[model samples]
Target: MAPSFYETLVERNKQYAETHNPAPTIAEQMALGRVFETTLVITCVDFRLNPDQFLQTKPEDQFLISRNPAGRVGPALQEIMLFDVFLGLKRVIVIHHTDCGGSQFKDADIREAHKSRLPDHSEIDHMVFGAFDEVEQSVRDDLHLLKTSPYVPKRISDQSLGFVYDIKTGLLTPVE
Candidate 1:
Protein backbone atom coordinates (compact mmCIF):
# COMPACT_ATOMS: atom_id res chain seq x y z
CA MET A 1 0.00 0.00 0.00
CA ALA A 2 0.98 3.61 -0.40
CA PRO A 3 2.21 5.74 2.53
CA SER A 4 -0.34 6.43 5.24
CA PHE A 5 -2.05 9.84 5.42
CA TYR A 6 0.21 11.09 8.22
CA GLU A 7 3.30 9.86 6.38
CA THR A 8 2.23 11.63 3.19
CA LEU A 9 1.50 14.80 5.17
CA VAL A 10 4.98 14.70 6.75
CA GLU A 11 6.64 14.22 3.37
CA ARG A 12 4.68 17.11 1.88
CA ASN A 13 5.48 19.30 4.84
CA LYS A 14 9.18 18.58 4.45
CA GLN A 15 8.99 19.63 0.81
CA TYR A 16 7.11 22.78 1.77
CA ALA A 17 9.61 23.70 4.50
CA GLU A 18 12.53 23.30 2.10
CA THR A 19 11.00 25.57 -0.59
CA HIS A 20 9.12 28.19 1.51
CA ASN A 21 10.81 31.60 1.72
CA PRO A 22 8.74 34.40 3.29
CA ALA A 23 9.40 38.06 2.60
CA PRO A 24 12.17 39.82 4.57
CA THR A 25 9.88 42.79 5.22
CA ILE A 26 7.42 40.52 7.00
CA ALA A 27 10.18 39.28 9.24
CA GLU A 28 11.45 42.82 9.91
CA GLN A 29 7.94 44.02 10.74
CA MET A 30 7.43 41.13 13.15
CA ALA A 31 10.70 41.91 14.90
CA LEU A 32 9.60 45.52 15.33
CA GLY A 33 6.26 44.38 16.90
CA ARG A 34 4.28 45.47 13.86
CA VAL A 35 2.63 42.70 11.92
CA PHE A 36 -0.88 43.07 10.50
CA GLU A 37 -2.04 46.59 9.62
CA THR A 38 -5.78 46.15 9.50
CA THR A 39 -8.90 44.17 10.36
CA LEU A 40 -9.51 40.62 11.48
CA VAL A 41 -11.37 38.44 8.94
CA ILE A 42 -14.12 36.00 9.85
CA THR A 43 -15.02 33.73 6.95
CA CYS A 44 -16.49 30.35 6.11
CA VAL A 45 -14.44 27.18 6.38
CA ASP A 46 -15.27 26.53 2.71
CA PHE A 47 -12.32 25.32 0.68
CA ARG A 48 -13.23 27.45 -2.36
CA LEU A 49 -13.05 30.92 -0.80
CA ASN A 50 -9.38 31.60 -0.14
CA PRO A 51 -9.09 34.92 1.74
CA ASP A 52 -5.77 35.98 0.24
CA GLN A 53 -7.12 35.68 -3.30
CA PHE A 54 -10.49 37.21 -2.40
CA LEU A 55 -8.96 40.15 -0.53
CA GLN A 56 -6.21 40.50 -3.15
CA THR A 57 -3.59 40.58 -0.41
CA LYS A 58 -1.08 38.14 1.00
CA PRO A 59 -2.64 37.18 4.34
CA GLU A 60 -0.12 34.69 5.68
CA ASP A 61 1.42 37.00 8.32
CA GLN A 62 -0.74 40.05 7.69
CA PHE A 63 -4.16 39.01 8.99
CA LEU A 64 -5.99 37.43 11.88
CA ILE A 65 -8.28 34.88 10.23
CA SER A 66 -11.17 33.06 11.86
CA ARG A 67 -13.01 30.34 9.97
CA ASN A 68 -16.29 28.75 10.97
CA PRO A 69 -19.13 26.89 9.23
CA ALA A 70 -21.00 29.99 8.06
CA GLY A 71 -18.26 32.44 9.09
CA ARG A 72 -20.33 33.37 12.13
CA VAL A 73 -18.38 35.25 14.78
CA GLY A 74 -20.78 34.28 17.55
CA PRO A 75 -18.92 31.03 18.22
CA ALA A 76 -15.58 32.84 18.31
CA LEU A 77 -16.59 35.52 20.78
CA GLN A 78 -13.74 34.89 23.22
CA GLU A 79 -11.00 35.05 20.56
CA ILE A 80 -12.47 38.19 19.02
CA MET A 81 -12.71 39.89 22.43
CA LEU A 82 -9.11 39.04 23.27
CA PHE A 83 -7.87 40.31 19.90
CA ASP A 84 -9.84 43.51 20.29
CA VAL A 85 -9.02 44.25 23.93
CA PHE A 86 -5.39 43.16 24.11
CA LEU A 87 -4.03 43.01 20.56
CA GLY A 88 -5.40 46.43 19.52
CA LEU A 89 -7.12 45.02 16.41
CA LYS A 90 -9.66 47.70 15.54
CA ARG A 91 -11.70 46.27 12.66
CA VAL A 92 -13.48 43.08 11.59
CA ILE A 93 -14.32 41.72 8.12
CA VAL A 94 -17.09 39.15 8.03
CA ILE A 95 -17.28 37.24 4.75
CA HIS A 96 -20.00 34.73 4.01
CA HIS A 97 -19.87 32.96 0.70
CA THR A 98 -22.46 31.94 -1.88
CA ASP A 99 -23.49 28.26 -2.04
CA CYS A 100 -21.95 27.44 1.33
CA GLY A 101 -22.57 24.00 2.82
CA GLY A 102 -23.69 25.68 6.03
CA SER A 103 -26.58 27.25 4.10
CA GLN A 104 -27.85 23.88 2.82
CA PHE A 105 -29.69 22.91 5.97
CA LYS A 106 -31.98 24.45 8.54
CA ASP A 107 -31.67 23.98 12.30
CA ALA A 108 -34.60 21.63 12.28
CA ASP A 109 -33.12 19.63 9.41
CA ILE A 110 -29.87 19.29 11.32
CA ARG A 111 -31.65 18.32 14.52
CA GLU A 112 -33.61 15.61 12.79
CA ALA A 113 -30.55 14.32 10.97
CA HIS A 114 -28.65 14.10 14.25
CA LYS A 115 -31.55 12.33 15.97
CA SER A 116 -31.73 9.80 13.19
CA ARG A 117 -28.00 9.13 13.28
CA LEU A 118 -27.73 8.87 17.07
CA PRO A 119 -31.03 8.00 18.61
CA ASP A 120 -29.81 8.06 22.24
CA HIS A 121 -28.18 11.50 22.18
CA SER A 122 -30.87 14.12 22.73
CA GLU A 123 -28.41 16.88 23.63
CA ILE A 124 -27.97 17.82 19.98
CA ASP A 125 -30.96 20.08 20.55
CA HIS A 126 -28.76 22.53 22.38
CA MET A 127 -26.48 22.98 19.39
CA VAL A 128 -26.94 25.85 16.97
CA PHE A 129 -25.36 24.63 13.73
CA GLY A 130 -25.23 28.22 12.41
CA ALA A 131 -26.99 27.33 9.19
CA PHE A 132 -27.98 30.19 6.89
CA ASP A 133 -30.89 30.47 4.48
CA GLU A 134 -29.69 33.61 2.72
CA VAL A 135 -25.96 34.33 2.49
CA GLU A 136 -26.14 38.14 2.55
CA GLN A 137 -28.62 38.18 5.43
CA SER A 138 -26.36 35.88 7.39
CA VAL A 139 -23.48 38.28 6.85
CA ARG A 140 -25.62 41.20 8.01
CA ASP A 141 -26.81 39.31 11.09
CA ASP A 142 -23.28 38.32 12.10
CA LEU A 143 -22.02 41.89 11.58
CA HIS A 144 -24.82 43.26 13.75
CA LEU A 145 -24.03 40.74 16.45
CA LEU A 146 -20.36 41.67 16.46
CA LYS A 147 -21.14 45.39 16.55
CA THR A 148 -23.56 44.99 19.44
CA SER A 149 -21.51 42.54 21.47
CA PRO A 150 -20.32 44.05 24.75
CA TYR A 151 -17.20 41.86 24.66
CA VAL A 152 -15.95 43.56 21.48
CA PRO A 153 -14.32 46.99 21.91
CA LYS A 154 -16.20 50.02 20.62
CA ARG A 155 -13.50 51.00 18.12
CA ILE A 156 -13.45 47.59 16.50
CA SER A 157 -17.21 47.21 16.60
CA ASP A 158 -17.77 50.53 14.89
CA GLN A 159 -15.52 49.61 12.01
CA SER A 160 -16.76 46.07 11.46
CA LEU A 161 -17.76 45.22 7.86
CA GLY A 162 -19.64 42.44 6.10
CA PHE A 163 -19.36 40.92 2.64
CA VAL A 164 -20.63 38.03 0.54
CA TYR A 165 -18.08 36.21 -1.57
CA ASP A 166 -19.28 34.81 -4.87
CA ILE A 167 -17.38 31.62 -5.48
CA LYS A 168 -18.25 31.39 -9.19
CA THR A 169 -17.31 34.97 -10.05
CA GLY A 170 -14.54 35.52 -7.48
CA LEU A 171 -16.20 38.79 -6.52
CA LEU A 172 -16.79 40.15 -3.03
CA THR A 173 -19.95 42.20 -2.61
CA PRO A 174 -20.36 44.41 0.46
CA VAL A 175 -23.41 43.35 2.45
CA GLU A 176 -23.95 46.70 4.23
Candidate 2:
Protein backbone atom coordinates (compact mmCIF):
# COMPACT_ATOMS: atom_id res chain seq x y z
CA MET A 1 0.00 0.00 0.00
CA ALA A 2 1.43 3.40 -1.07
CA PRO A 3 0.80 6.65 0.78
CA SER A 4 -1.48 9.10 -1.09
CA PHE A 5 -0.07 12.35 -2.53
CA TYR A 6 -1.84 14.41 0.17
CA GLU A 7 -0.45 12.17 2.91
CA THR A 8 3.08 12.55 1.60
CA LEU A 9 2.66 16.33 1.36
CA VAL A 10 1.26 16.49 4.92
CA GLU A 11 4.16 14.42 6.28
CA ARG A 12 6.70 16.66 4.52
CA ASN A 13 4.99 19.84 5.76
CA LYS A 14 4.96 18.51 9.34
CA GLN A 15 8.62 17.58 9.17
CA TYR A 16 9.57 21.00 7.76
CA ALA A 17 7.57 22.80 10.46
CA GLU A 18 9.23 20.76 13.21
CA THR A 19 12.74 21.45 11.86
CA HIS A 20 12.21 25.17 11.12
CA ASN A 21 13.41 27.73 13.71
CA PRO A 22 12.38 31.40 13.85
CA ALA A 23 14.82 34.29 14.43
CA PRO A 24 14.95 35.04 18.19
CA THR A 25 14.22 38.82 17.91
CA ILE A 26 12.03 38.78 14.77
CA ALA A 27 8.92 37.75 16.67
CA GLU A 28 9.34 40.39 19.39
CA GLN A 29 9.66 43.37 17.02
CA MET A 30 6.59 45.56 16.64
CA ALA A 31 5.16 45.39 13.10
CA LEU A 32 3.05 48.42 12.24
CA GLY A 33 1.38 47.92 8.85
CA ARG A 34 2.14 50.70 6.40
CA VAL A 35 -0.54 53.26 5.56
CA PHE A 36 -1.09 54.65 2.09
CA GLU A 37 -4.08 56.08 0.21
CA THR A 38 -3.30 54.60 -3.18
CA THR A 39 -0.29 52.46 -4.17
CA LEU A 40 -0.54 49.79 -6.85
CA VAL A 41 2.34 47.54 -7.89
CA ILE A 42 2.38 45.91 -11.30
CA THR A 43 5.05 43.31 -12.03
CA CYS A 44 5.81 39.96 -13.70
CA VAL A 45 4.25 36.60 -12.89
CA ASP A 46 7.48 34.76 -12.07
CA PHE A 47 7.11 32.54 -8.99
CA ARG A 48 10.71 33.08 -7.87
CA LEU A 49 10.43 36.90 -7.92
CA ASN A 50 8.40 38.95 -5.44
CA PRO A 51 7.82 42.70 -6.07
CA ASP A 52 7.60 43.59 -2.37
CA GLN A 53 10.94 41.92 -1.64
CA PHE A 54 12.62 44.03 -4.30
CA LEU A 55 10.87 47.27 -3.27
CA GLN A 56 11.46 46.71 0.47
CA THR A 57 7.76 47.34 1.15
CA LYS A 58 5.54 46.24 3.99
CA PRO A 59 2.63 43.88 3.25
CA GLU A 60 -0.13 46.52 3.54
CA ASP A 61 1.63 49.31 1.63
CA GLN A 62 0.33 48.53 -1.81
CA PHE A 63 -3.40 48.91 -2.43
CA LEU A 64 -3.59 46.80 -5.60
CA ILE A 65 -1.30 44.40 -7.42
CA SER A 66 -1.55 43.29 -11.02
CA ARG A 67 0.89 40.79 -12.54
CA ASN A 68 1.28 39.54 -16.10
CA PRO A 69 3.92 38.29 -18.53
CA ALA A 70 6.83 40.77 -18.71
CA GLY A 71 4.72 42.95 -16.39
CA ARG A 72 3.33 44.73 -19.45
CA VAL A 73 0.09 46.57 -18.91
CA GLY A 74 -2.29 45.14 -21.51
CA PRO A 75 -6.08 45.51 -21.91
CA ALA A 76 -6.90 43.64 -18.69
CA LEU A 77 -4.49 45.79 -16.70
CA GLN A 78 -5.98 48.93 -18.23
CA GLU A 79 -9.32 47.97 -16.71
CA ILE A 80 -7.71 47.44 -13.31
CA MET A 81 -6.29 50.96 -13.51
CA LEU A 82 -9.75 52.40 -14.09
CA PHE A 83 -10.99 50.93 -10.84
CA ASP A 84 -7.90 51.78 -8.81
CA VAL A 85 -7.51 55.34 -10.07
CA PHE A 86 -11.19 56.38 -10.12
CA LEU A 87 -11.48 55.12 -6.54
CA GLY A 88 -8.70 57.56 -5.47
CA LEU A 89 -5.59 55.42 -5.43
CA LYS A 90 -2.53 57.71 -5.44
CA ARG A 91 0.39 55.91 -7.07
CA VAL A 92 1.16 53.22 -9.62
CA ILE A 93 4.50 51.40 -9.43
CA VAL A 94 5.53 49.61 -12.59
CA ILE A 95 8.15 46.91 -11.98
CA HIS A 96 9.84 44.72 -14.58
CA HIS A 97 12.49 42.26 -13.45
CA THR A 98 15.63 40.96 -15.17
CA ASP A 99 15.84 37.41 -16.60
CA CYS A 100 12.08 36.95 -17.13
CA GLY A 101 10.68 33.90 -18.99
CA GLY A 102 8.72 36.11 -21.40
CA SER A 103 12.05 37.52 -22.62
CA GLN A 104 12.68 34.12 -24.29
CA PHE A 105 10.05 34.69 -27.02
CA LYS A 106 9.53 37.43 -29.56
CA ASP A 107 6.17 38.96 -30.46
CA ALA A 108 5.83 36.84 -33.62
CA ASP A 109 6.91 33.71 -31.78
CA ILE A 110 4.38 34.24 -28.98
CA ARG A 111 1.59 34.92 -31.48
CA GLU A 112 2.40 31.78 -33.46
CA ALA A 113 2.64 29.66 -30.31
CA HIS A 114 -0.71 30.94 -29.02
CA LYS A 115 -2.37 30.37 -32.40
CA SER A 116 -1.11 26.80 -32.42
CA ARG A 117 -2.11 26.06 -28.82
CA LEU A 118 -5.48 27.80 -29.11
CA PRO A 119 -6.63 26.45 -32.45
CA ASP A 120 -10.31 26.98 -31.70
CA HIS A 121 -9.81 30.76 -31.33
CA SER A 122 -9.01 33.18 -34.15
CA GLU A 123 -5.34 33.27 -35.17
CA ILE A 124 -3.67 35.97 -33.02
CA ASP A 125 -1.51 37.65 -35.60
CA HIS A 126 -2.44 41.17 -34.53
CA MET A 127 -1.57 40.76 -30.86
CA VAL A 128 1.76 42.61 -30.76
CA PHE A 129 4.13 42.30 -27.82
CA GLY A 130 4.63 46.02 -27.18
CA ALA A 131 7.64 45.63 -24.89
CA PHE A 132 9.74 42.67 -26.03
CA ASP A 133 12.98 41.78 -24.18
CA GLU A 134 13.70 45.25 -22.82
CA VAL A 135 12.89 45.30 -19.09
CA GLU A 136 13.46 49.05 -18.61
CA GLN A 137 11.50 49.86 -21.76
CA SER A 138 8.72 47.51 -20.68
CA VAL A 139 8.33 49.24 -17.30
CA ARG A 140 8.35 52.67 -18.89
CA ASP A 141 5.91 51.53 -21.57
CA ASP A 142 3.55 50.12 -18.93
CA LEU A 143 3.61 53.40 -17.02
CA HIS A 144 2.87 55.25 -20.23
CA LEU A 145 0.00 52.94 -21.02
CA LEU A 146 -1.49 53.31 -17.57
CA LYS A 147 -1.13 57.07 -17.70
CA THR A 148 -2.56 57.37 -21.18
CA SER A 149 -5.24 54.70 -20.97
CA PRO A 150 -8.73 56.14 -21.55
CA TYR A 151 -10.11 53.91 -18.81
CA VAL A 152 -7.68 55.33 -16.27
CA PRO A 153 -8.18 58.61 -14.45
CA LYS A 154 -6.40 61.57 -16.01
CA ARG A 155 -4.55 62.41 -12.80
CA ILE A 156 -3.26 58.87 -12.24
CA SER A 157 -0.46 59.46 -14.68
CA ASP A 158 0.92 62.36 -12.63
CA GLN A 159 2.11 60.13 -9.81
CA SER A 160 3.09 56.96 -11.68
CA LEU A 161 6.74 55.81 -11.47
CA GLY A 162 8.55 53.06 -13.38
CA PHE A 163 11.26 50.81 -11.94
CA VAL A 164 13.45 47.93 -13.12
CA TYR A 165 14.46 45.18 -10.71
CA ASP A 166 17.85 43.50 -10.97
CA ILE A 167 17.50 39.85 -10.03
CA LYS A 168 21.23 39.28 -9.43
CA THR A 169 21.87 42.23 -7.11
CA GLY A 170 18.34 42.66 -5.71
CA LEU A 171 18.24 46.32 -6.69
CA LEU A 172 15.22 48.41 -7.75
CA THR A 173 16.41 51.22 -9.98
CA PRO A 174 14.07 53.95 -11.26
CA VAL A 175 13.47 53.98 -14.98
CA GLU A 176 12.31 57.62 -15.29
Best candidate according to lDDT = 1
Judged by lDDT against the true structure, how good is candidate 1? 0.83
The root-mean-square deviation over C-alpha atoms between each candidate and the true structure, in angstroms, is: 3.0, 6.3
Residue pairs that clash (backbone atoms under 3 angstroms), model 1? none
Best candidate, TM-score: 1
- Give the poorly placed runs of model 2, Cα more than 4 Å off: 1-36, 85-87, 117-120, 128-131
For every model shown, the clashing-pair count is 0, 1
Model 1 per-residue lDDT tens digits across residues 33-114: 7745556889988888788777777644456788988888899788887776665686888999989998787888888998
| lDDT values, one for every candidate | 0.83, 0.72
lDDT at position 65, candidate 2: 72
Task: For candidate 2, report its TM-score.
Answer: 0.70
Give the Cα RMSD of candidate 2: 6.3
